[model samples]
Target: MSYHNPVLLQESVDALAIKKDGVYVDVTFGGGGHSKEILKRLGGNGKLFGFDQDPDAQGNVIDDERFVLIPENFRYISRFLRFYDVRKIDGVLADLGVSSHQFDEADRGFSTRFDGDLDMRMNQKSKTSAKEIINDYSEEKLAEILFLYGELRNSRNIAKTIVGKREEEKIETSLQLRKVLQRHLPKAKEHKIIAQIFQAIRIEVNEELDVLKEFLEQIPNLLNEEGRLSVISYHSLEDRLVKRFIRTGLFSGEPVKDIFGNSNVPLQKVGKLIVPTPQEIKINNRARSAKLRIATIKH
Candidate 1:
């Protein structure tokens, strides 16, 4: 299967406003789809750096001398870039959330269609996995993640159900966990509820929200003057952070204003929120929930 079909390919890259010889970064270089597009827009002197913590993505690394793939999480983007003496970058593109490749691989435990071990770590090297979260997390902790990340209203009850079931046998696989929560799944909303449960565990196991926040905090310092940031977030939690940061340069609370009421924000939104066209969604169902937000460093 194809590693991943790039979503909003032209739109996201165009938002970067690529400079021929400018430096760029694709932070979520899952299948190198967006990275390849960025390379096409670059001249001989142009350089591109890609970051992916997943060992699976290493095989897809571009062979071009001008391209470099850093096998590390983008939360450490600044620190890693500094190692290459890259002090400032012209643009950065991020396609956040799990990749299609990850979802299609049943053993990786990302999709509801398949029965596999409960492992959803973006970087397989990570210590925590969905199996651990399902089998070991406190009911309260599980409920909190379900409520916050998955936005499930009956999170406490669902978490309670899992806890009750696991006491008899450890929930080691996706199917096992799904069966345990069968009560919560009416035929009408079974898939949706299970997906939400999986998403909650996946987020906790990978610390996705925290990692995203860390990565966003580094962008203002990493970009050159007028440097562009194009991020495609797959869900509301991720999109909200990107949107608020671009508007106020902070995740929460209003930006501080001067006596005259002028606020000093680091990044400004480039345009209105962008989403996949119906045609694009038809081609790639995963693109249905994708939201692309563009921003540039404030002058």
Candidate 2:
């Protein structure tokens, strides 16, 4: 089966403005779609390092001296790059969120459509899983996760139901857990609401927001002068961070200034945010929510 079709492919690549011999990094190399494109624009000496936490992503790796696939999380991208003996790079591209392959694989339990194990860990090596969140977390913590991460309006009731049901039998599978929390869901909007709740749980399980912050903080140290960053965030939460970081060099708050009024920051915005054209979204509805932000280190 084909790996995921990279969302906003041309838009993302073009934003990078690839140099003939520049080094680049694809922080989330789901199926190598963007990595392959980066390689195509490179000269013989150019190199591309790709990172993916999921082992399943490696199955799509291409055999090329120009490409190096790292089966690790992008949160430690700087460490891995340094270990690989790459000190600085020309650009970085991050397409965040779960891949289509993960969702399609029902056993992974990332989607609401399937009844499977409640394991949403992107990297199986990781100890924390969705099952732990649902089973081990206290009622208060569970409600917080659903409300903060999932944005479920009835988070309190859902958490209450989960805690109430798990006492009788552990919520082992997605179906079992969903059935228990069914009461909190609106009858007419069950499907979409359930999906949002699941999304929240998966975000907490993966610690995605925290990982993203760490990764973004390292970008200034990772890039050479004028090095570009092209990030495609799938939801508002992720997009807000990316936008804020690019604009102010901090996840929140205004950019800091020196006594003399000079800004103290490493990155500068390139252009207004980009979203998918209607045609692209029509073909792949998943692309609809994607927001692409581009920036470059201070030259």
Candidate 3:
């Protein structure tokens, strides 16, 4: 089976607006689909760097002089690039969220379709895992994760049930936790509700929001004038942050305005939001939720 299929392949690459000898970064190099395409477009002098916390992706590492694989998280994109003497890049692309391989592997516990341990850390080296969050977090904290991250309407009941159940026995596996949440699961939307719960835990385990924020903050400094950022987010929360940052240079509110009343914006939105076509979504169901946003630093 394919390790992973790239989403919005052509559209995303086009968004990069690659120059023949320009430097680029593939911040979420899952199966290297986007990176491979970038390599194809690059001239002999061009270079590409990839980041993936999962060791499983190491096998997909290409052995090209211009291609370098960093088995670290993208949150450290700037630090690692500096280590490699790469101060600026012409473009960066990130396809965020759980990779297809992670969802397919039952042992990784990133999906509701399988029975496995509740460990959802993208980086195995990371200390916090879904298992810890489920088994050790306080009731209030659990409620917050469900409500804020999962966006579950029944978050209070789910949290109450989890706290009440865990006292009798530990919840270590996905199935065990699923059973606890099953009561609150909407019968009409079982698949979606469960997926949301899994997503919340996965995000928490990987510190995805924090990582994305750090990664975004570094983009302006890392990009050359007119450097582009092409990001494909799999959910509304991620998409909203990307959209806001690209438009106003901040996540929560508008960028500060000068006394002259002109709002400060670091990156200009390159194009309207892009989504996979019906044909692409038919071939890859995962593309259904994907949203592509592009922006370029003003010269």
Candidate 4:
């Protein structure tokens, strides 16, 4: 159950500004790293709830009276918390995207470094897998995911190639998909290109962006007054959504201002973007691209 190193371990949790007896939620409770840390800082009567859709995470759940592991997705944070007779929360933490263990486990198909099946479902029970996307999706849909999620410049050509190859033989595995686009992978940038392709498919399979939006939309209403939100995002896509949401409370367009010229937003940014230091990145390569953003409910 060695899930992940939990990037920004102290920084992200500290950003929560934990009150000894405050109730908190860890939306991505992979490995229970952050949750465990929160427990150490909680006093008597403090409660901590965690949510993780991945079955593997359940194995790493901490055995403590103060902690409750909700074996569900964070997108339904509010609903599940209500079932426990919990309404207001003092803080929430979300470590967005796939966990390190998911990528390292070849069978999961999250990493381009591994040669495994094309199964990139965050929740093992998910219906739409990376294999389905590559084998059944239309050329247009494939290209859209590649461009939007992977940010690949030649997404159209890549999608056309995948469609053309799948017509001859099913693209059932990660290596097969890579071999299909071999010509596109220049020797120098092969790994980078392939990683992008894998990322695009994984995102689509998990409906990651949609889930993130839904989870974030519920944060404001769930948090109590002066509640804090700490999020660590690995890529620009997730970071952008979080950054924009905290600043304007809207995914797009500016927040409307009153006659006094004050815009009404749900949360206010706590401080500047926090990134891993050189020491952290050296120890955990995954922390290199990580960005931590903290915000509090607007009064």
- Superior by TM-score: candidate 1 or candidate 2: 1
Clashing pairs in 4: none
Q: What is the lDDT of residue 44 in candidate 2?
A: 94
The digit string of per-residue lDDT tens for model 1 on 1-299 reads 29999999999999999999999999999999999999999999999999999999999989999999999999999999999999899999999999999999999999999999999999888899998888888999999999999999999999899899889989898888888888899999998888888888889989999999999999999999979999999988999999999999999999999999999999989989999999999999999999999999887
Steric clash pairs (candidate 1): none
lDDT of each: 0.94, 0.90, 0.91, 0.93
User: Which residue pairs clash in candidate 3?
Assistant: none
At residue 212, give the lDDT of candidate 2: 94
RMSD of each: 0.8, 1.2, 1.0, 1.0
Encode model 2's per-residue lDDT on 56-168: one tens digit a residue: 99898978899999999999998999898998999999999988889888889898888889999999999999999999999999999889887887889889988998999
Runs off by more than 4 Å, candidate 4: none
Please give the ranking of all candidate structures by lDDT, highest first, separated by commas.
1, 4, 3, 2
TM-score against native, each model: 0.99, 0.97, 0.98, 0.98
Candidate 3, poorest ten consecutive residues by summed lDDT: 247-256
Report the poorest 10 consecutive residues by lDDT, candidate 4.
1-10
lDDT of 3 by residue, 130-171 (tens): 989988989889888888889988888888998899999999
User: lDDT of candidate 1?
Assistant: 0.94
How many pairs of residues collide in each model?
0, 0, 0, 0
Error of 2 at 182 (Å): 1.4
